[model samples]
Target: MTQTDRTDTAERPDPPESSESVATGGAAQAQSQFRRAWTRFRRNKLALASFVVLVALIILAVIAPLIAPYGFEEPDYEHTLAGPGTAGHLLGTDLLGRDLLSRLIYSLRTSFLVGFGAELAALIVAVVIGLIAGYRGGRAEQFLMAITDVMFAFPTYLFAVLMVAVLGRSVGAVILAIAIASWVNMARLTRAQTMTLMQRDFVEAARAMGAPGVTIAVRYVLPNAVGPLLVAVSFGIPAAITAEAGLALLGLGVQPPTPSLGGMIQDGISYVTSYPNMLVWPAVMLAVVLLAFTWLGDGIRDAFDTTGTRR
Candidate 1:
């Protein structure tokens, strides 16, 4: 065939396409990606099981108030620290005869709140710093990176403790502390990704067309950078949760009356030698939740990675 015929054939639309068909095609592509990811994720049976356990734990947390026979705080001084499987006290009682299971459920809720809050804050800071640093590449980049470097220099727990000390010990303060220290890593990650995306053909084309800096950054750079950022966000949640737990362990987080996984674990520390189940069960749940998030992040990272397909 002549070159003209070949070009025309390549450009031709499919025969008799309707809006329904276009919608159907788009849905099919989405389903295909979903199925591919499911297939890959299921291949790791341990990860799949961990994800299921995490989901169940979250559901239990949401329904804890409804399910508990006794209130989390309604103390039964008459039956303090009753052994496991005691009358109406499922999973046993705390030092004050408060339901261990109920406390655990509430703790999960608080931990997740801290995790999500910190993750979102980190995402925003990272995107802004990364975009400006990557695109501008001069004084702004150096200054922001210098700040990020200072954050990175301290140990995670040490940074968190200092922030809480300065900011005082509210839930928001704890979350803010973790977010401030945590976001620098994400900023560096996003900045590296933005640098790569800025060099791509589409970015060059946008620049050639005289697109505004904000427009090009948002439209061209950000979309390309989103997958890695999402993966980072997923992984970052576990880190944030761990940070909150560490702060609570140090008696500087979540405060009284607001149960967090860390706080629950801290409450059990005194009784750990006597009733180790109190400490053991909470630690296990925290580990499982963190591992599930890490696995999910890994799966997402692998799914979005074109290099996997190339291999």
Candidate 2:
């Protein structure tokens, strides 16, 4: 070979990496991001405690049927309104003689159902609308955002009340109502994230390569935007749970014998002076759920933050 040819060959860079290597690298990067976020989350004592508590509560709710001393509706008419530690009723019995502890366990299951179900529904609607509005960016964006703005004007609780009233009171109705009322925040956050991601070089490259809008959105934009979206969802869940509780308090949530936290609170209100434990137990459980979710959400948001600011 010519001396000049040998020199040019040495100057050339290594060939582009194979597709398998690229995929593996992407996976590793994602794993690293997860580890960093987890590390940050673990460092926050309140958040770590909340995670453990939340997981334990979920487990308790799941196995409630096995552990509960009595059926939620099964009454011990002999011990009606009995205080805590009465015979088989550890936490006492309601006016109907139903075990308070058993009802509380079932109520927790109901709350979790509403929280996760509503959040899942809200995520679907929010992500779809946000992606279309931000990625398309035209009259479509203007129209969709206009609707979102109108939704924002209504008070969330009032809107949820109206929906539940219209749909009729039930678990399914409560889930749908809370989802409709709560999706606006997620949609707005998602839109902002998608808009920012669209300006990225990778997105531009995908577009230049003739990728369809859907392909670019799913393959490039959505994955990049997921971190912020998850943070939004973590925050959104507690709101959904609270909304359900409020609706139940107002007699528009899960119906009688269903044993929702709010319903228990409503029932307990009548006996507040006579037997405060009835009111206190459900209220305490609700407070724990709310605080756990709020603190955990704060931790997740902080962990995902790239700004390196500790709260």
Candidate 3:
């Protein structure tokens, strides 16, 4: 109504208080989302079973020395290649007289470490590249897609084998090889999700406000895209682990004295007629690990899917 009234209205603290309320609401929403996701995940019996199995394997791997009566690399000359139920060897003895049980436990640790590490590396690279490429579109998207196509054309196993051959047999080489081969899927998944998210109302609002490209992509796009990305990651770990084992079985993964499940299984091929425990334990371990990841991924997919059943 007057100059003083105009000044008073302009100086009112309502806007700041409103902004604070909005920020608080956003934080509450994020926490609620995480809680709902966890609740959904826990309700799935198969997923919970997988989580329990994963936790058990982790515990076994962590306490390998205590749980395993003998060292992974220790050789019992008198008990070499003993079948299951041998005097001291629980799972039996390998061709080298080493304890199969110990090796199996240690192999679990190595498999998980390599798988998780490789997947994480691939995931980081894929998410970053895919988000940027998809968000920017045009030439960047085309170029990235072209490169992804090229990668997809080559068989992953062949690429990994070649990389391992060049890099020599070692844990690091195996991890790098698998990561290189595996990242394409992650990249594609992230790109597709990012493209979809780019059209959402929040993103449009951010664009209207003249927010930076990076800010919009990171703040809005990535959060929405993480659901599928997590599913991809869950499956990726087992894939990497199996890949590593396969490579090692072919003598391109990890070298001897390293005690890898693949290496043990490969060696067991020679003693299958004499002692079956060597092959049995490794195969069982691999199966368990794969199953755990498979169930976990299914659980995660269900957790995020509105149409998915709770169990």
Put down candidate 3 lDDT per residue, 1-311, tens digits, no spaces. Answer: 99999999998876433433443443355456667889989989999999998999988888887887787888999988887778777777887788888888888878887898899999998998899788999999999899999998999999999999998877888888889988998999999999987776667766666778988787767877777888899999999999988997787878778887788788877767777677878888899889989999999988877664544
**Decreasing lDDT order of the candidates:** 2, 3, 1
Model 2, 1-311: lDDT tens per residue? 99999999999999975544543444355467778888888999998899899999999999999999889999999999999899878899999999999999999999999999999999999999999999999999999999999999989889999999999888999999999999998899889999997886667666666778998788777877788888888888888888888887788879889998989998999999999988999999999999999999999989988797767
- lDDT (CA) per prediction: 0.81, 0.88, 0.83
Local error of candidate 3 at residue 119 (angstroms) = 0.8
Candidate 1 lDDT by residue in tens digits, 241-293? 99898888898988877778888889889989998767877888898899899
Off by over 4 Å in 1: 1-45, 309-311
Model 2 stretches with alpha carbons more than 4 Å out: 1-31
Please name the candidate that would achieve the greatest lDDT relative to the true structure.
2
After TM-score superposition, the amount by which residue 184's alpha carbon in candidate 1 deviates from its true location, in angstroms, is 0.8
Angstrom error at residue 201, model 2 = 1.9
Instruction: Evaluate residue 104 in candidate 2 and report its C-alpha lDDT on the 0 to 100 scale.
Output: 99
